[model samples]
Target: MRLHFLGANKQVTGSRYRLEAAGLNILIDCGMFQERPFLKRNWNDPPFPPESIDFLLLTHAHLDHVGLVPRLVSQGFNKPIITVEPSVDLAEIVMLDAARIQEEDAQYKAKRHQKEGRRPKHTASPLYTVNDAKKALPLFRGVKFREPVQLNDQVTVTFREAGHILGSAFLEIAVKQNNATRRIVFSGDLGQWSTPLINDPTPLDTADCVVMESTYGDRSHKDAGTIEEQLANIITDTTQRGGNVVIPTFAVERAQELIYYMGKLIESQRIPTLPVYLDSPMAINVTELFHRYCRYLNEESRCNFEQRQTPDLKFPSLRLARTAKESIAINNIKGTNIILSSSGMCTGGRIKHHLRRDITNPNATILFVGYQAQGTLGRQIVNGDPEVRIHGRHWPVKAKIAQIFGMSAHGDRDDLLHWLTAAKQPPKQLFLTHGEEDAATALAATIKEKLGLKVTVPDYEQTIDLT
Candidate 1:
């Protein structure tokens, strides 16, 4: 068997891996490079021919894991794209939104370049169109959690709950050859334990080789209860000061989680009821999915919805902004209303417009409830840059910037270690990916010192033999 690390080797986004086993060529995650320095990779041709891939295994519907599949399909890939059921629904929404954004961006850039009378260095065209994304949708094959799906006579794959998001999972594959079976696991963005809405990450006792994510390998998140407390304090303080709380949210898990917490706070009388607007159509659609997949949610959230008839994410003060006019109307609201918009990293979306307005308002609180990758606008704000360019104009940074670290969907250092140590037997080799260099390196050292296991942090396009 052989494994290839095509992307997300020493970076946080763009996660692609190729595995060859039992005469089958399988691809895992065909993600987009989101950081500014690596955005060029999104336009590059696949290192291997797209048609050569036989199957695409998706762990979740996060853009970083499923964003580039449409482009891959447009390049001649026609294969089965397998993932959990909820991810199937979520991926369709994410890809279509991504294609629309790309097409709009391309048109905007072309017009700007023409007006300036300057030829652009790069092609002012979309990487893929909405039609391309649509063609890729028919290939998806949704499977239930923990169900084993046979790839061929010699290999079988299983999906297990990752507890990261609605339908996130870690993959387990078994390959039989020469009267022996070899096991491999791919840890796809593990989540924290005892978090609301979702169950804890499922643990596996054994594997021969493993590839894991190290997104937060260097630190620990604050306790979950503390996250709500900090969120309440920030919103309450901002409201008392007659300012809004503008949050850059991820459409999938982060947005729903924030809404749930805000609902709880209001119900408990911990924070005064204020207008809470979900300002992105995509996030609004995703919130509705929470109701459809209530069974996938944790017992408390599920019971609260089914038995109490009170959705944890709904309250009298909450509003869904689904149209451009509705989104614009939010800016005119008098005071202290909370707005949640996407994309979470502020790479693109209505969040930028919100930020452009509130980042300069002294009483406003710009809250971040998700991870911020480097070279993105969100990172620039979080890093305390005095002035930032948005829509080609510089804006002063006067707002109170706050982040709730415990709200991250990705597990932290201690969580990762606990997941590993719980395994009945350590894998012969462990490969870490999906993190910046410092985080991966820190995790490697800690694993070596504590577990005495052989670990490797592969580079982009690196290939290794699995013995």
Candidate 2:
């Protein structure tokens, strides 16, 4: 078998992997590149011919894992896309929202360039359109978790809960070649154990080879127990100063998790009851889906919902801003309130508007609860940039910046080690991807020292033979 590391090798975005074995080709992911330095890859043609692949095995719905499906379809990848059931619904929402953002951004940049009498290095066309996303939707085929499905006569795959987000999963794949069967496991964005809404990652006892993520390989999470306390303090401090608290959030698991904690704080009166505005329309929609798929949530979350006698996500001050006008009106609200918006890395979205309005106010606070990829606005702010450009203008960064470290959905170093140690026997080979160079290197050393296993950190577009 030959494996190709097409992306997410020494960086944190654009995750794609191709496998060729038994005269068949399969692509594991076709994500868009989100980091500023690599964003051009989203517009570039696929390194491999899209039509040459026989199938796609999607692990989850995060944009970095599945964002480029529409572009793949536009480029002639006409094969079945397989994933867990909930991911199908969530991915559709994510794709459509991405397409809309692309179109809007393209138009905005074009007008800005025309006004400035200068042009971008490349044509300012959207990577893919909404129609392209529509075309890609029909190819999705959902399967239940833990059920083995035959992909062809030579290969079978089973999905297991990853605990990263709703319907996120890792894959257990078996390939039969030369009358010998080889087992390969792909750990797709494994989630932290004891997270509120999702189940813990499924443990794998064996494999011939393993491909895993190392998003947080260099460090362990901060104490999870202190997340609520930190949040309460920040909110209390910001509100007491008569300023807004703006949080740039991921539309999926992170946004809901924030609401869950904020609800608890309000109920306990640990923080004053202030209006909480969920400003991203996509997040609002995803929150509703969270309700529809409550069965997939963990037992603790279920019990909390039962005890609340209402939806677990609902709080008295919560407001869902579904329309553009409603979103705009949030800026005019009087006194101190909490505004949660998306494009978590501050790449794009309503969060930018909230940041523009509040970032320069010394009385306000900016709270980050997720990873910020390099070259992103969030990273710049977190790194203490005094000023940042947003919406074609620069703004001062005077707001107090804070991060709740334990709220990340991705598991940290110790969690990754725990997951790996669950294997009854070490695999013949282990390859780590989906992290920056420093992070992947740090993890490789730890695995070799602690587990005494051979580990390879593949480079982008590099190919290796799986013996």
Candidate 3:
């Protein structure tokens, strides 16, 4: 078998990998590069022909993992994109949103260049159109967890729960070659063990070789308090100061998780019952999907609805801002309220508009609940940049910036180790990817010292022969 480290090598975004086994070309993911340094990679031609790939296996619907699907489809890749059932719906939403953003961004840039009376360095056009995303949508094949999908007579693949998000999964591929069976495991993005909303990640008893994500592998989330506690304190303090609490949210799992927590907090009266606006249309749709896919949720979240008949996402003060007019009107509200907008990394979407309004207001609070990739606006703000350029203008940062480390979906160092150790027998080789050099290297050292396993941190575009 030949393994190709296509992307997400020594970096946190753009997760794509290729495997040549059983006489098939399988692509693990087709993610976009969000960090500033790697943005050009999204436009680069695929190292391998897109049409050559027989199948695409997605881990989840997060933008970093699935954003480039439309581009791949536009580049002549038309094949079965397999994932969990929930991801089938979620990924479509994410891709459509990304395509829309790409179009909008292109128009914005073109107009700016025209206004400046300067020609753009390159043609101001979208990387991929909405039609491209639509084309990709038809190729998705959603499967149930643990259902073996046979690619050919020699290869079978199964998706198992990864606990990272709704429908997130790690992959188990079994190959029969030369009268022997070998199993290869890919840990997509392992989640915390006992987190809310999602079930724990499934443990593996054995594997012949393993590929895993090393995001947050260098450190632990030893924050001062739990997510709920920190959230309550931030909201209470911000509300008391007569300021809106603006949360830059991810539309997928993070947005829904915040709503779940906020609903519980309001019920207990831990924080004042202020108006909560879900401003992003995409996030609203994803939250609604959570209701439809209740079976995929953790036991506690499922029981909350089944036993008590309680609305997990609905409350009297919770408002849905689905239209552009409604989203604009949210900024007109006079008093304190909670606004959750999408593009968690502040890379795009309505969160930029929300930040434009609140970022200059000292009373307002900008709270982040997810990891901000380096070079993203969210990272700049979290890093305490005094001034930031947003929407082509510089704005002084006066908002009280805060973050809840414990709220991240990716598991930390200890959690990754625990998950790896779950294997009854150590694999012959392990490859770590999807993290910055420092983080991946740190985890590599620990794994070598503790597990005494042969581990390699492959470089971008590197390939290795496993057999």
Candidate 4:
């Protein structure tokens, strides 16, 4: 068997992998490159023929993990896209939103380039159209967790809960060759332990080889218990100053977690009753999905909903701004309020609009509750860039910048170590991916030193043979 590290090898954004075994080609993920340095990769042709792959396996609905499906389909990938059932619903919402955004961005860029009397190196069309996204949707095949599905005579696969977001999963694949069976485990973005909305990552007993994520391999998160207190303080300080608390959130897990915490804070009277606006239509749709799949949530969140006789995500002061006009109206409100919007990394979305409007207000607070990839607008703002370009104009950074590390959905160094300890026996080899160079290297060293396991941090497009 051979493994190809296509993307997310020594970086935090794009994530793709290919496995060639038992005369079959399986692609793990086909994600978009979001970091500025790799953005051109999105327009490049697939390194391998799309038609040559037999099947596609999606780990979750995050854009960095599943954003390029439409583009792949447009390039002739015609096989079934398999994932957990809830991920199908979420992926549809995510992909359609991505398509709309790409279309809008393409049009805007074209007009601006024309005004500047120059043309872009590439065609000014969207990466893929809405119709392409629709074409990819029907090919999705959702399965129940832990059910073994035979892919062919030599391969059987099972999905286990990853606990990162709704319907996120890690894949356990067994491949048979020459009367021997070898097991491979893929850790698909493991979540933090005891997270509020999602269950803990499922523990695995054994595998011949393991491919894991190391997004936070270099540091530990703050005490999770203090997250609520930190959020309360930020909100209180910003509201007291009569300024909005603008947050750039991921439409999936991060946005929901924020709402869950805010609801708890309000119920306990730990924070004042300030109007809170959910300003992205895509995030609003995801919030509704949370209701539909409430049973999948953690025990505490499920119990909270049961006791309240209402969704835990809803609170008296919360408002869903689903229309553009409603979003615009949020700026007209006189008093202090809280606004949560997405794309989490501020690569695009309504969050940029919110940032542009409030970034110059020293009283305002721009809160980031998730990881910001290098070269992203969120990273620039968080790194204290004096000025940032938004909507074709430079904006000064006068707002207070804040972050709550404990609230991140991804697991930290200790959490990753704890997850590894669940293995009954250390695998023959462990490969770390989906992190920056420093993070992956740090994790590889730790696993080798502390666990006495053979570890490697693969480079982009590097291939490894497993025998």
TM-score of each: 0.98, 0.97, 0.98, 0.97
**Mind giving the per-residue lDDT tens digits that candidate 2 earns over 174-217?**
99988888988889898899888889998876788999999999
lDDT score of residue 68 within candidate 1: 99
lDDT of model 3, residue 31: 90
Candidate 4, run of 10 with poorest lDDT: 116-125
Give the clashing pairs for model 4: none
For model 4, how does the per-residue alpha-carbon lDDT over 169-233 read when each residue is reduced to its tens digit? 99999998889888998898999888888899998767999999999999899555588899999
What value does the lDDT take at residue 289 in candidate 1? 86
**Model 1: residue 90 alpha-carbon error in angstroms:** 0.5
- Please state the error at residue 257 of candidate 4 in Å: 0.7
> Runs in model 2 with CA error above 4 Å?
120-123, 303-309
Query: lDDT per residue, candidate 1, 352-448, as tens digits?
Result: 8899999999999999889999999999999999999886689999999998899889999998988888888999989999999999999999999
Candidate 3 TM-score, C-alpha based: 0.98
Residue 120 displacement (Å), model 2: 5.3
lDDT assessment of candidate 2: 0.90
Clashes of 4: 0
